[model samples]
Target chain A: MKKLFTGVCVAAALSLSGQAALADVLDDIAERGVLRVGVKADYPPYGYLDEAGNIVGIEPALAQDVADLLGVELELIPVVSSNRMQFLEQGRIDLMIATMTDRNDRREVVQIVDPNYYSSGTNILAPTAAGLTEWEQLDGLPVCGIQGAFYNRKTEEEFGAEIVAFTGTAEALAALQQGTCVAFVYDDSFLISRLSEPEWADYEMPLQTIDDAPWGLAVALGEDRFAELMSGMIVNWHLSGRILALETEYGVDNTPFAERMHQLFLDINPSIER
Target chain B: MDGIEAWFLDLYHTTGINLTIVYDAFDRERFLWGLLNTVILSVICLVFSVIIGIIGAWLLGARHAIPRRIVQAYVQFFRNTPPLVQMYFFFFALGPMFMTTVERHVGQMVFVSETPLLTSFHWAVISLSFFAGAFNVEIFRSGIEAVPRSTIEAAEALGMSRWQIYRDVILPLAFRICLPALNNNLVNLVKTTTLAYAIAVPELLYMSNQIWSDSVNVPEMMTVLLFVYVGLVAILVFAMQRWERAMKLPGFGR
Candidate 1:
C-alpha cells in the first residue's frame, strides 16, 4: 500500500509540473495553426449562429480574417458574457472577440487591444403605449433591466426609477412584452438588434443615448506579444477596407449610429487603405 | 444626511438623468417571473434530489460491502468537485445526449415543434438536481445511521417487515434528524439556480449583466445586485430556520 501511494503521488506531481510547463497560449496557437477565439454565440450581427447552425457574424468574420493573416485557422468557441473573462485567463481560448466594452476593471485583468472597432451608448426602450418622452417621465415607474448592467445605480440615483433587474436579456424582454415594466434599459446596439427582430418591432426607443462606450478585444493580461499581434490584425483589417466591407454587408451603414461609429473608426486609424 | 445630499448632488452633476430611471427599469412582471422561476427550479430540484438521496442512502447503507463501496466512491467524486464544473460538463458535454433523448421520448407528446426536446429550463433543473442530489445522499445516509439500531430490531421482533419498519419508524426518525441539514441544502439549491444564467436561461443575474454592460456604471449596478441577492438569500434562510424549528424533536436539545 505504501509503495502504491508513493507511485500515485509521484504521478500526480508529474502531471502538475507538466501542466505548468505548457507553452504560452499565443505561442501554442501559432504553432498549432489555429486561434481559438471566445465569442458570444447569441449577440446578433456580431457573434451569433446563423439559420444553418453555422457560427457566422461580424466578430467571427473578423477573427477568421485575422487567423488567415496569421496563417492559422479560426476556431470560434461560443462563450456567454459571464464566463468570457474566465475562459481567456484559463487558456481555454487564445483571445476574446465578443462585444466586450473597455472598462478599467476589465483592463486590470485583461489586455485590451488598441483601436476599438465600435462605439455604443446606453439607451432605454419603452412600449408605444407608455408614451414616455423624457427621462423624468420614468420617475416612479417600474423599469425592467438585467442585473450586472452598468445603469441600475445611475437610473435609481439620477432618475429615481424603480429598477427591476433580471439576469438575462430574454427575461428583460419578456418582462417588457408582458407589461411588467413600462420601459427596458439596455445598450443602443443591442436595442437596435432586438428591435429589428419581428417580435420587438412594436417597441421603440424612448430615452436618448447615454454614455458612448468603446468596445475592444481582450487577451490574457501580461501577454503583450499577443496583444500586439491582435492590434496589428485590426489595423491591417482597417487599412484593407475589410471593416468597411463588413459594414456594407451587414447594412449597418443604414443606421446613424453605425455611420458615427465608422467615422470614429477612421478618426482613430486614418491610414486605412480604403 | 451629508452623505445623502452629496450622493444626490453628485448624480445631478454627472448624468442629468434622475432617480426615475431606476423606477422605470423595475418591471414588477419580470421580477415576479424570475421569482417564479427561482421557486419552481428550487422545488422541483428539491423533490427530485430527495428521491435520489433516499435511494442512494439505501444503496450505500446496504449490507453488501462492494456495492456500498461503489456508491461511496460515486458520492465522493461528485461531492468533491465544484458545482460550476459539473454544470458546465453537463451543459456542454452531455447536453446533446439529453436533448436527443428528450426529443425522442417527449417531443411529440408535449409540443408541435420538431426540436421540442429538453428546453433550456429543463437542462437547468436536471443539472441542479444531480448536483444537489450527490450531497443529499451523504446527508441522508448520515441521518439514517444516526437512528438507533435498537429501534429497528424492536420493530422487526414485533413481526413488522423491513419495509414496514423503515416506513413507520426509521424514515420518520431519520427525516427529523436531517431537517436542519436538509434546510441548508434547499437554500443552497435556490442560490445555485443562478448558474442557469450561463446557459442563457434568462434568470436575474444574466439580465443584470446585460444592463451593466450597456450602462457603463458597473459599480452602481453591481452594488444594487449585491443587495438584491443578499436580501433574497436572507429571506430563504429565515424561512428555512422557521421550518427547521417547527420540525424540531421534543426533549432532544436539552
Candidate 2:
C-alpha cells in the first residue's frame, strides 16, 4: 500500500512540476497579447448587445479592465448562463465575468475569486392587475422564469409556484405578455431594467424580492495566480467606487450591496481616492 | 427512504457527483411526473396521429376532389414546414386570437388575458400529431395501395357499403401492412416530444433541465435523462413489435 501510494504521488508530482510553467493564466494572458473573457450577450446592464451589434455592458467593461491590466487586447466571448462555466472549464475563455451566482457547487467547477463583484435577488415581474403582494401569492399560479436561474426551484418549492422555465428572456417575456404565466420570476436587477422600458410600463415588481445571492466572476479552476490577481482587482474596484459609477453609467439603481462593499473597502484602506 | 436520500447526498458530497433526482424529494417527484407527462404526451400524439393518418389516407380516395385536395394540402404543409414553427404559430399567433381580452387597465404589462381554449400542451399535441400524421398519411396511402383490387372488388360485389367496405376491408389490411412504418413514425413522434420543451410543456427534458440548472449537476442529470429516454423508447419498441406479431397473417413468419 505504501509503495502504491508513493508511486501515485510521484506521478502526480512529476506531472505537476512538468506543467508548472504553463499553469499561471495571469502570465499567459500577458504573453498571448489577447485576453478572452466570457460575458453575457443578452443580459442588459451586465453584458448585452448595443444597437451597433457590439457587446457592451458593465460586465464587458470589467472584462476590458482585466485585459488592460494584462496590457493585452480584450476579446469578449458571448455566453449564456448554461454554458459560461463549461466554456471557462474547457479553456475556451481565460476569464469569465458573466453574472453568475456564487454557489458552493459552482465554486467546485470554477475558481470564483473572493469578494464577489455584484449581487441580485429574486423577484416577480407581475402585471399590476395581478395584484401580487406576497411571495405566497405565487402559489399554484404559473410563473415564467429563465431556464438557468438559480432561484427557479426555490420559487417552485417554497412558494408552490408552477415554474414555466424557458430557454431565454425573450421567450419568458413573451409568455408573460401572452398571459401564459401570470408573473415572471427572475433576477430583480434584470427585472428593474425591464421595468424602465416603456413596453413594461404597466407591470410592476410587486412582491418583496427574496433569496439575495451575490454574483461571482470566475476563472477556470487551478488558475490560482489569476484568481489572486482578480481578488486584488475586486478590492480596487470597491475602493475606487467603480461599481457605483458603473451603476450610474448603466442606469441601474445604486444597490445597497455596492454601497456596503465600498464602505467596507474604505475601512480597509481609507487612503484610496474615490 | 431517508437512508437512500442520505446516501445520495453523501455520494454527491464525497464524489462531487450530484444527482438531485435521487436525493431531492421535490426534484424526484417532479422528475417522475415529467416522465409520466412524456409518456402521456407520446401516447396521445401517437393515437391521434394514427387516427388522422387512417382518416386522411381514406379521404384521398374520396369521391369529391375537394376532400382529396384538402388532404394533399395538409400533408404538404405539415410535411414541408417545421413542427417547432407550427407549434409557435399555434401558441403565439393563433392562440391569443381566441383569448378574450380582460379589463384593459393602463399601459402594457397589465395586459393580462385569460388562457386560450387550447393550452400550450394542447397546441403541442395538435402540432406534433399533425406533423407525424402527415408522414403517416403517406405511409398508410402506400399501404392502402398495396391492397389487391380483387379482394376490395369482392367485398364491394358482396353488397358492402362504401363505408363498410372501407371500415372492414381496407383499414385492417392497410393497418397491418403499414404497422412497421407506423411503428417507426410513432417512435419518431415520441422522440419529438422533447420539442415541447421550447414551448414550456414540462416534459422529461424540460424538467430534467430545470433540475440540472438549479442543482448544477448537468452531467449527472443528463446521464439520467439519456437512460430514461432509452428505456422509454425500448418499451415502445417492444410493445409495437408484439402488436405487429399478434396481427401478423396467420401462417406468415418474419
Candidate 3:
C-alpha cells in the first residue's frame, strides 16, 4: 500500500521536465504515429458523440488540426472533468482539449498552452418561472454543480448557494431536472446549449455570467515542443477566426471572448483574412 | 490548533505540498463538516442495520411461512445487488415516487415544490442500512442456529413461551457468538459510508475532493484522507474487539 501511494504521488506530481529518465512526449507521439487527444465526448459543440457513434465537435476538429500538423492519425480519447488531467499525465493522451478552465494550480499538474483556445463564464440554469434574476436569489438554495469545477466554491461562498456537486454534467443535469436543486450552476456555454435543447425548454440561464475563465488545452508537463506548437496553433485559430467559424457551425453564439481574440490577433497581422 | 495551522502553512512553503484543510479556514471548515457527516452517516446506518437484522432474524423463526419467505426475499434482494446501484435506485428511482408537491405561496413562476419524503442523507442511511442488514441477518441467523437445540428444548419443556425463551435464553448466547462476525460487518459498513460522497452527502471523501480541486494538492489531500479513514476504522475495530472479549460466553468456543 505504501508503495502504491508513493507511485500515485509520483505519477500525479512528477516534474518530468526535471527528470532525466522521461523522453520528450512529442517524440513519443511522432514515433507512435498516433496523436491521441483527449476531448469531452459528452460536452456538445465543444466535444460530443455524433449519431454515428463517432466523436466530433469543435474541440475534436481542433485536435484534427494538431494531428494534421504533426502528420499523424488523429485519435480522440473521450475525457471528463475528473480524469482528463490524469490521462494527459499518464501518457494515455498526447493532448487534452477537454474544457478545462486554466488556473495557476492546474499549471503545476499539466502544461497548459498559452493564449487559451476558449473561454467560459459561470451562470445558473433555472426554471424561467423561478424569477432568479440575481445571484442573491440563490441564498440558502440548493444549486447543482459539476464536481471539480473551480466556481463551485465561489457560488457557495459569494452567492450563498448550497452547491450540490455531482460527479458529471449528466448527473448534475439529471438532478436539476428532478428539482433536487433550485438552479444548476455551470459554464454558460453548456447552460446555453442546454436551453437550446427541447427537453430543457422550461429552464433558462437566468443570471449574468461571472468568473470568466479561459479554457486551456494542455499537454503533459515538460513537453516544450508540443506546448510551443499548441501556442502557435491557438494564435493561428484566433488570427483566422477559426473558433468564431466553429461556433457558428456548432450552433453556439459567437461569444465576446472569441470575437475579441480575433480582433486582437488581426491587429498583429492585418493583411491576413479568413 | 493555531500552532498546528502555522506549521502546516510553513510546510506548504517549504515542500510545495499544501494541506489546506489544516491551515485554510474555508477548506478546514468544510472538510471538518464532511468528517462529521461521515461519522453520523456510519453510526446511524450501523445502529439501524443491527436493529433490522435482529428483527429479521427473529422473523425467520415465525410460525407463518409468509414472513419467513419475505425476510428471505429481502435478504436476497439486498445481498445480490450492488450497494452503489441500490443507493442510486433509492435516490433517483424510488425517491421520486415518494415526493409530495407543495403549494408555492403568493405567486411566482414554477419553482421547487418537489419535496421528497427522504433527503439524500436519509436515502443513504436507508440504502446502506438495508445493504448491511442483509449480511447482519444472515450472521445472526447462524449464531441463533448454533445455540444447541437441547437448550431450546429445555426452555420449551419448562413451559417458557417462545418469545420468552428467545429473549432470555437464545439471544444472550447467540449475541456472544455473533460478536466477531458482527464486528467485521460493522467495520465494512463504516468504510461503505464513503459511497455517500457520490450523492453529495458532504462526507470525508467528498470534502477531500473539493479541497484538492480547489487547492490542486491531490497528493497532500489524498494522504490526509487515507490517514483519517485508517484512524476511524482502527478505533472501530479496537472497540469491537474489546466488546468481543467482554462478551465472551463461558464454556463456549474460545
The most accurate candidate by DockQ is 2
Q: For every model shown, what is its TM-score relative to the native structure?
A: 0.47, 0.72, 0.74
Candidate 2 residue lDDT tens string, B1-254: 89999999999989999988987888899899999999999999999999899999999999999999999999999999988889888887888777754542322224345756577899999999999999999999988898889989999899999999888998888889888888899989999999998888989999998888878889999899889989999999999999998888885323
Candidate RMSDs in order? 17.8, 9.5, 10.2
For model 2, the local distance difference test gives 0.85
Provide the lDDT at A212 for model 3.
83
Tens-digit lDDT string for candidate 1 (B1-254): 55665675578469753332244334433444555676677778888988888888878867789879887887887788877677656654555454221111121222111222454567778878877888888888878888898988899899998777777887778888887788778778878888877655556665555544654545765676577777877887887788777878797534
- Residue-level lDDT of model 2, residues A1-274, one tens digit each, is 3443344345445433434556477667667889999999988878999999999999999988878866899999999999999999999999999989999999999999877888888888988877777888677778899887788888888888889888888989988888888889988988978986889998988876677789999989998667766776787688799999998898777777788889987876577754
Candidate 2 stretches greater than 4 Å from native:
A1-118, A215-274, B1-17, B100-112, B251-254
Stretches of candidate 1 above 4 Å error?
A: A1-274, B1-22, B25-28, B63-70, B99-116, B215-220
Q: Which has the better DockQ: candidate 1, or candidate 2?
A: 2
Looking at chain B only, the TM-scores across the models are 0.77, 0.92, 0.94
- For residues A1-274, what per-residue lDDT tens digits would candidate 3 score against the true structure? 3443344334324433334355687677778999999999888878888999999989999999889877899999999999999999998998999999999999999999877889999888987768778887787788889888889999988878888898888878877777777789888988867876899988778776787889999999988766766777787788889999998998777777899889987876698864
- Give the docking tier of candidate 2: acceptable
Better of 1 and 2 by lDDT: 2
Residue A187 lDDT (model 2):
80
